[model samples]
Each structure stands twice: as structure tokens, then as C-alpha cells.
Target chain A: MAFISRGFHGRRPSAGTKLPPGQYETTGFPVLSAGPTPRIRQDDWKLSVTTEAGKQHVWDWAGLMALPAESPTVDLHCVTKWSKFGTEWQGVSLDVLLADVETAAEHVLVTSYGGYTTNIPLADLVDGKAWIAYGYGGSDLAPEHGGPARLLVPHLYLWKSAKWVREIELRPSDVPGFWESAGYHNYGDPWREQRYQGD
Target chain B: MARAAIPGRLGDRLRWRTAEVTGRRVESATAVTLTLDLPGWPGHLAGQHVDVRLTAEDGYSTQRSYSIASAPNGRSLDLTVQRTSGGEVSPYLVDELVPGDRLELRGPVGGWFVWRQQQTEPILLVAGGSGLVPLMCMVRAREAAGSRAPFRLLCAARTPSDLLYRSELRQGAPGLDTTYLYSREAPADSPRPPGRIAPEDLVRSGWPPDFEPTCYVCGPTAFVEKTAAYLVLLGHAPERVRTERFG
Candidate 1:
């Protein structure tokens, strides 16, 4: 068969760069969701962290922004194979939010306003690895992009970074969330191309 | 009574199978429909999509998801490709591929947006640009099943020339009503101004709010976002409006 060369859709990483395998860099942000975008009212929005022991911590939209917010520039890789490099987001680190809360949980289930939920290791949420980002590109996050507040877990596939995030429930053991129960890998590390289960 | 089992290769969803291009037809200037013959082809519901992967000689490959344009048939299905400018796979599929060529595909993906023959509610389908692909499948499925479900399609295209399935849509299907909204070029006899589909278009062409039509909106993210929002604002339950965002 002859070589079938096609034009590159976007920029490709230089050698030795850390863009994930089987992924291409896209300058444009792609909106992906299983259902309609939830129209959440800011005045009514709240972020809560609950432990299996019934202890709870809550923060409203204003109170969350009043906390120490930091801007982090990171690359987001989606299981759909699109990666955006050097995207800037502003939010409070999950470490700070969980600092005073006491929990012996090993798993965290992030829930959103739209009834979307995704699970990740409790370790993945703390130690400065995750953020409850409410702003992107220096502006208030748009609702369609999981704005107001979306969990940013830069290391895992974007699906694990649940959009419209509102709550984080700490559990003693891992339970598969929405996509995990469907067919996606539980721990979606784009570097290993862990897209589907058993990958 | 015993239930009929799902036939064909109901195997792993991630597994990619080789499909041969059995037929190709120019759907429009920018689009072509490639008919594929799959090995152990499992039939798909209306509105499902398949991922097509192409490999270069160097082994570099890329995949894109395209909606299945034809209704359930034998082992054959049609994928309509629109030549997206600067797109990696679309240009090749639209202009280069010929009959007898082969590609790897994984699917009948997406169960949410599907239209089943048993569903009796009125359906409101809104398409923006090439987003018409999946909705066309539902229309074709309705025709193939000889079902008389109420279906209204509001196709938003750049111009009359860009409208897909022009002849067939004009010929019409049983109980199907199609309205064309041209953002750039409207026909000389068009009653609508050349503009994007608006809330008024929904009120005028779509079923009334009382009809409780299940709406499926697909297209570029912007179009889907706007159309779905409008449908919900116009009194339809948020749950009734399903959307598929395409770039």
C-alpha cells in the first residue's frame, strides 16, 4: 500500500515532550458531555466535602473565591484523544479545602450539579494535584465548560475531571463512577493509553 | 414469551474491525457517503455513531467519530463525510478514498441519543451544518420500519446548495416535516431571512410545547448549546432535550 500522508490537524509536540500517547494538541477547547449542560445558578451553588462518618464541610461560591486561589497552567488530555497544552485556570487547591477535614478515606467521588460523578484516588485530589477551578483564561468559567467550578485533575483523562463539580464524598474504597461503570478505565492515565477497562 | 437476542458480533466495544468500502456516492459538493461492509456487523439503532481510523505507511494513525447515516440493514452501513477544512481524516475520506478501500472502525457507539422504533413521542430534530448526519439516520430508520412517528427536522445550513439529502428530503418520508434555515444563502422563494435558526423558528416549525416532543440537537458545540437552551427555555423539560456536541 502507498503511504497515505494527511495534513496535521494541530501542533505536534517536539521530541522528549510530555504530551500523552495517542493524543494531539488542540488550541480550541472541545465541549464534551453525556447530556445537556446544567444551568446552575451561582447564588444557589455550594461546594461540600463529606466523610463516610457524616462529617461535612461546605463553601458557597463567594466563600470559595475568597480562599487562597492560585492560577495553574497545565495540559488537559481527554480520552477522546485531544490534548490542550498550557491552559491556564484559577482555583483553590483541593489540599487547602481538605486541610481541616479529617478523613481516613482512600477514594473520592466527585459529584456535579448535573448528576455527573467520577471517582479518583483520595491521594490524587490532595498534595496539590487537583483544584476546584472556577475561572479559565482570566475570566469566570463558562457553564458549558464545567464552569463556575469544575474539578481539574490534570494527570488523569479529562473525564475524571468532572465538570460542574459540587461535592466530594470520601469513601473507604473505590467505586466506579458514571463513565467507569459504562466502559472507561477506572484510572485513566493518558500516558499509558488507559482509555477502556483492561487497557 | 421469549425475547429475541441481539444478533451479530456483540463483542468487545473497543475492538476495531476491518470494513471495506463497498459503495460511494456524492451527497453534496462538500460531502460523500461511503458504504461499508463489515465483518460480523452488528446492527445499530438510529442515531448511533462509529469511529473510523486511518493508518499511514509510517503507522501514524488518527480516528474521528462519524454518525451512521443509514438505518439498520444487513452488514452494510453508510458513513457520510464532510470535508472539514484542515481536518486530518475527513479530507482523505471525502476526496481520496475509493470503492474497495478498507479502514478500521469501532462502534455503534452512543446509546443515549438513539431513536427507537418503539418510541411513539413526537421527535424534534435540529441539525446545524454537517450535524444532519445522525438525524438523517433516524429519518431513514423511520422510513425503513414503515413507522409513522411524527418527526420534524429543522436543518440549519450555510446555503441551499449545502443542504444534504436534498432530493430525498424534498421527496419526504412518512410523517416527516423538514424546515430549512439558511444562515448565508436562502433560495429566492424562501420565506425565512438568511440567518441562523432562531427561537422563533422553533416556535414556527417545531411541535408546540404541549406536544412534548423529544428533541435531539446535534452540530457544532455553539449551535447545539444554543438550540438545546432555547428548547428548554421554550417550556420543554430539560430531560427531553438530548444533545450531541460535534466540533
Candidate 2:
């Protein structure tokens, strides 16, 4: 019967601030600009891969899990400056995805719903530790965390970690992602601590 | 679900140290300075911040960012931490943590939020309370960059001690135009004027009527929101003004 909730933190939280358990992922991940999963049902979730050469790939749930999977203990850096470290995730390595495919390109372009697209350098895309996650923590990846599938980049800034990813296109050179195109730093490195003003 | 399993040599975990808390001082009721060891450290740019995370015995953890107060390239990273009454982490950091206690920290994050003394006009930095951390980075960076632009900083604090880097601001005040506004207390000896920085006051900050200089604003949400509003009203374009919000 109240008029409204304050919905205020009083002040903006400084970078590196962490929320306690039970509070983790409470609000979901759109805050990361990591796209949300489509509202459709399980049968509706699909992933597609297109090579710059025009070869197209389409996969349903079973097909994606059929690919190899892996995980890594990594820190996720955000343009907002919050670096969530020690998060464990599971997915098929991007390297594994390209294992049977051949391409002369050295970069990747990841696009999801909500117009979220990110570019990854060829080497970064192939990190043995990096994976196309089908699950997170220990369960099937929830839709909020890109559900069924997501691209987990443990080393780079978390923004490079694309959610609800549908396509991975191989390109010849480095390209910027949506936020990067908007003023975030390119090739975001936590150790380098490159937060914004990409070169 | 369980944590997702990815693979990698966790590698050298950024050769970090517990960084012994060398000293802790009570500058004000709500503000404190903790200087820690960072010997032989690589310098960071001005306006950069460090990530400080604390974990509970239950395994729940949180990492929050703090700006570097230590001099650029200095041996230690001095962070002037302010306690927000309801803040989950900062209160513990200010009231509980002690010297010799190590903290999990990483340094100097942020890029565009920096200042280059060279090729710059007199620097204009807007900070509220501890929002001054990164602004302090620009001050140090400007000195290191050796630019001649008169560095200027306008800080809004609740009081003198609440002002995170009061001494440094005063010492560095020779060439800069520094203001300290208190929402709570005012010192009899403080040279700067006292009171809130209203939009009208910011508009009359004494610059040439036609001057359009680079301006950087950092502080709490409301401070940043209002300050930016005032700057735009004062004729500074939106894009020309940059902001970093510190809760």
C-alpha cells in the first residue's frame, strides 16, 4: 500500500565493490550490457555461427552441448570498473569450435539479441581457458547469465564475456565490440587495468 | 548450479602482497587514510583506482574500487577511505581494519578518466567527498606530465577532516584553485569558502565567459548528476564533460 520504493543506494558504489551472498546476481546481468536470453522456450534457444567466407552454422540445444566444453578460474572486469574474480564457468572452448573449421581470419565478432556484439582478437578467442559456456557455477546456465550458452572470457574485461551469443564470425583483423565502439577500451586487460578510452 | 568449469593455468596471480597497512590516521569522523606498502611498484596514471575486496568466513565476498591517494609512482598506494554509514564494506575498512593487516588489492584501473598536464588547459576537476581519489590521480599525473596548466579542483566534503586529501590539497593549492565545501562542519582556519556548490556558483567559477576547457567530474551519484547538470547549464557541452561516479 506504500506509494513507492526509494530504490536508491544513497550514493553510487565505487568500483571494486562486491555484494554479499544471497545478493549475488540478485538483479541479473543486463547491468553488464550482457544481453539477456530470448523469452522463448527451450526449443526456441538456438545458436548460429557464420564464417566471413559465408559458411553458416545453426545449432539447437543438443547440438551445442555435443561440442567440447571447458572452464577456468578467471576475473571478469567491467567497464563500470567492478572486477568479479574467481568465478567458475563451463562451456565449449572457442578453440574447440574452430578446431574442425578453417579460416584465415585472426579475430571474431560475437552478436547476440539486444544488439550486443563484441570483437575478440584471434588469440583471445582461442584461449584454452576461454569457453562457450553452457552452464555456470554448477548448473545449467540460467537465462539471466545467458542461460543455455554464453562466451566466457576469463582474462579480458568481462564485457568481452558475451552472453546469449548466437554467432562467432572469424575476421581477418581486430574489430571493436558495441561498448568498445562507444568509448570503452579495446583489448581490455585487468592487469593493464584498461577500463576505457580504447586505442 | 555449480561454478562453471573453464580451463587455464591460473598463472602467476598478479604477484600481489597483503600490503601491510603501514599507517592509519583519523583525519575526520567519517574519513581515514590507510597507507600501505607497494615498494618498487610500477606507477599508475592519475584518475586511476584500485580494487579492494574483502571476504567473509562464510566465503561471501565483495570487491570495491578506491582511488589511489599515494603519489604517482610512489612506493605505496595511499587510499583515503571514507565510511558511508550504511556501506557494507567501507565501514569495516575504516573502523575495523588495522595496520599490519594485509588487504587484497589491485591497482590503477581507468584510462580516459585521467589528466595529462601537457597539452591541457588549466585542469578542472569536480569531486564530492572521497570522489576525490581519481581527481587526485589527475593532480599527480599533471605534475608528472609536467604540463603548465594551472590545476584546479573543486571538492565538496561534509567537513575539513571529511575531506580525504586535505593536506595534499592545501600543499598543492599554490598553483591551483581549490575549494572545500562542508555540509556539516567548517574550520576556522580553512582558506576556501564553505557551503554547498550550487549550479549558480559553479557557473560563476571565474573562467573567461568564452572559455570552454576540459572538465572532469567525480563523486557520489547525486553529486555527479547535479554537477554535470550545472556544467551543461554553464555552457560546457555534454560530451566535453566526463564523469566518474563513486558511491
Candidate 3:
């Protein structure tokens, strides 16, 4: 049995508030990164989607802007146990980005500017689920918050939404990325509270 | 690659263990340092964190991540927690918890943010408020290991009274240089005006970027974002500087 501290009662959530197990609601968007924030100029930034067969679909800043954009208000859950609700973001859906690309892969390895990477399932990236978020709160996304562009997978742990994201490599098999290979769960589903490997 | 450097049982599956609160020390008005006794505890590197889980009588449970504040010792470690206003876990840990209390925690969580004794290059540590907790572990670890690596700490706090580890930091150790920047208030004899850390402060108090020193910055999100930006603008390579931001 887990030990319960004496006279300890956590704050009770409101009647309608929805959060993953072990998560507490937070209004602030905390930044967690392994390295310093990369200052990527909008002109120099590019997003690439490469399939297992080696076909590449690359989008420059202007090209990405030309694509139809969606404004999404979603909740974000970090594996560290903070959940921010109803956060607004602006970006193109992954569905739009992958509409023309052909792939039979089931997994994706998201790579960022500073050597950070996280793996996700290809199914989670389509069907209006994920986005390559470039703006937040009606303004250009700040670099500290994965500015220029970052994958926004709100359904999973925020880490799955790799910050400073640059490439999405579709893979036929699951390959753990930086945190995954280290200790974080390979499939970071917040709802399941699958934080660590054994969990 | 960061995991490869972690020593001992930490490389294995991390399991939740019972941590008994052996002692506690008041750090500031809103912060307290907890000394924990964990049986079968594996050693941890400086700057790693632990996930503290607390369950209620009704089986409702929540967890929070806290950085380890003490140097690695057998079967024991310390965590300095700052009470966030309206927070669920911190208030309990800081105000209500006492000696002999037991909690569940799984730990030594981070790899990239750690400081190992083998690192010999000149080190720069920039801390904002409670962010000093992990960096203090590095300082203590350096002292414990008798390492001669040059260490420079630039800590920003609201005032001298808000500073944690004030007395110990005053009792300086060898090969370590300490600089304090007060964002709101400073003592009468302070060298600089009260303000946020600027690029010049990095040049004066931190190792020059050319020194290729490994830099660690930790703090609240805004503080870290600004300080890290200044470090990079001052010429530190993006890869050489590591950061950990707290909510």
C-alpha cells in the first residue's frame, strides 16, 4: 500500500475539470528541454517529413504558411504531472502535411533542432489530431516554447509534441528517441499515466 | 548518451520506494529542506530529480518532481521544496510534513541536467530563486569529492533574505566563486543595482564562453528563458548550455 502522509489532503478538482491521473491543473506553460533554446530564423527554418522508403516532403517557412492553417484550443498534459487546459495554438494539421506523402509506417521519430527527439505512432498524427504549431495565443510562437514550428500532439504527453521540431521520420517499427531510450515510456499516453518504462 | 554516464543501480529499472523523512530544515519563509532515509537507495548524480508521490486516505493520489538538493550519500538524500502558492503537494511537504513521515518516490530522474565529479572543465551555474537547489548539490558534491574544477555560480533572487543556503554559501568553499544578483532588493554593501541578470553580469560573474565551460541554468520558466537567451547572445554555444525549467 502507498503510504499516505498524515493530515495531507490534496486540492480537489472542480466538478467539471478533466485531467489525467496523477496530473494537477496548472495555468502556466512550463518549458522542459535538454539543451539551450535554439534561435532558428523563420527564413532558415524548414520541416521535413521522410518516409521509410526515403521519399521526402519538405516545407519551408513560406511554403508552410501557404498551407491552410487551423486554430486549435487544446489541453496539454506533461509527463511530469502538470496539465494546462484550453491552450490556444495556430498551425497546420499533420493530416494536411501528410496528405500527399505515402507511407505504410506505424511509428514516427520526431527530431528537433537541438538533437532532441521523441517517438510517436503515425496513427496519432493524422485524422485531425496533431499539428505543426507555429503560433500561440495569436502571436508567433516564442523560441522557448518551440517557436518557428513544433509538433503539437495534445493527446499524449507534451514531450511527444517535440519542441523545436524539424523532422518527422516515419518508421515501420517503434524506435525510442532521446527520452524514450533513456527512461521515459516509449508510448507516452497521458490518459494511461504511462510515465516510466514499467508503467 | 546521457544515461550511459549514470552510475550504479540508477541504470536499471527505477522502482518506487518508501522515503522516511528523517529531518527537516527551514530554508526560507516558503521553502524547507527535507532529509530522507530511503532503504536500498542507489546513489544519484548531482542535479537529478525525484518524483514524489503522495496518496490520500481515499486512494486519490498525485505526484510532483523535485530536484535532489544533497550530494549522494548512502541510503539518504535531501530535497529542498519551495511552496508554490495554492499548490497541492508543496504546501504539505513544506508546512505540514514532519520527521518520521513516509512517502512514495521514484528517482534520480534526469540525466542531462546532472553534474558528475569527473567533469573537469570550468563550470558555470546560473540559478533563479529556488533553482539553486540542484546547483547547491553540485557545489556540495564538488566539496565532497575535493575536486579542483573551477566553479562559478551566478544566483538571482528577490532579496538576500529570500536566498536558500545563505549561511553555507557565505562559508565559501575552494575553487568556487559565488555572485548574487538581486532582482528586487540588495544589501547596502551590494556591488550592483537590483535587476534581472544581464549579459554583462554573465561576463563579469561567469566563465567566458571561450573557456568552453559547461553551463547549467535552472529556474522558473520566464527566468530561465531570459537568462539562457542572454548566455547564448553572449557567445555560449547552444549545445554547451543546459537548462531545467520549473513551473
| Maximum-DockQ candidate | 3
lDDT rank order? 3, 1, 2
lDDT of 2 by residue, A66-100 (tens): 87666666556564545454677877777767777
- Model 3 off-target regions past 4 Å? B1-11
Per-residue lDDT, model 1, residue A109, is 88
lDDT of 3 by residue, A1-199 (tens): 5577678788767668887998998887788877678889999999999999999999999999999999999999998899998899999999999999999999999889888888999999999999999999999998989998899999989889988889999999998787776577788889898887767
Q: Give the number of the best model, judged by TM-score.
A: 3
Evaluate candidate 1 and give its CAPRI docking class based on DockQ: acceptable
Candidate 1, residues A122-196: lDDT per residue as tens digits? 989889899999999999899999977899999999999988888999999898777676556789998888876
Backbone-clash count (model 1): 0
The worst-scoring run of ten residues by lDDT in candidate 2 chain B lies at B1-10
Report residue A22 deviation for candidate 2 (angstroms).
Answer: 14
Q: Tell me, by lDDT, which candidate is best.
A: 3
TM-score of chain A of each: 0.92, 0.77, 0.97
RMSD values, in order shown: 3.9, 12.8, 1.9
Against the hidden reference, what TM-scores do the models get? Answer: 0.91, 0.57, 0.95
Assess chain B of each prediction and give its TM-score.
0.94, 0.81, 0.96
> lDDT, candidate 3, residue A153?
94
The Cα error of candidate 1 at residue A150, in Å, is 0.8
